[model samples]
Target: MAYSERLAERIRKALTHLPIKEKKMFGSLAFMVNGKMCLTAGPERMMCRIDPDLHEREVKRHGCNTVIMGGREYKGYIHIQEENLKSEKDFDHWVRLALEFNEKLTSS
Candidate 1:
């Protein structure tokens, strides 16, 4: 699966100050921060790693869906539709959420 360069660029700009590494993962472009998976840009969407405690609430938001694999739902990981990221605020929200979780992983 090919990823989106536009979205990838946006993410690149967002994490400009962070020690971020880009890698091909899950058939997408993944942003690894602090040596942990932070976010991923798919063709027309993104996967974000957030706080598991907030999963129930966050997934209820527009264009947000819990990441599921092998019939198991990954609470902290979410798939965000591209339509919901048309605005800067929404884009930033997802990026920040992923970064916050990455920070926690780094601290522990």
Candidate 2:
């Protein structure tokens, strides 16, 4: 399935002030900040790269689900249904979480 171009555009707008790049990964259009993947606008949902420590609480949020890939669960990545992104505020909230986490990452 193809990723959502519209959603990708919105994400682009939100991250415009940062040094970010767009790439195709996980069958989705991912937004990378400082060479790290911060978020992705997938075919049917938005993938948020948050703090792994918050996974248990975040997964309980509306339209959020555990991101399982290759039959394995990715602790820090969670999927947000399209329905949850109808509002720009909601969309930005997820983006903020992702950016916040990305900021905390140590430079390699």
TM-score of each: 0.95, 0.93
Local distance difference test values of all predictions, in order: 0.91, 0.90
Measured by TM-score, how close is model 1 to the native structure?
0.95
Clashing pairs in 2: none
Best by TM-score: 1
Show model 2 residue runs off by greater than 4 Å. Answer: none
Candidate 1 segments exceeding 4 Å error: none
Q: Model 1 scores what on Cα lDDT? A: 0.91
Q: What is the lDDT of candidate 2?
A: 0.90
Clashes of each: 0, 0
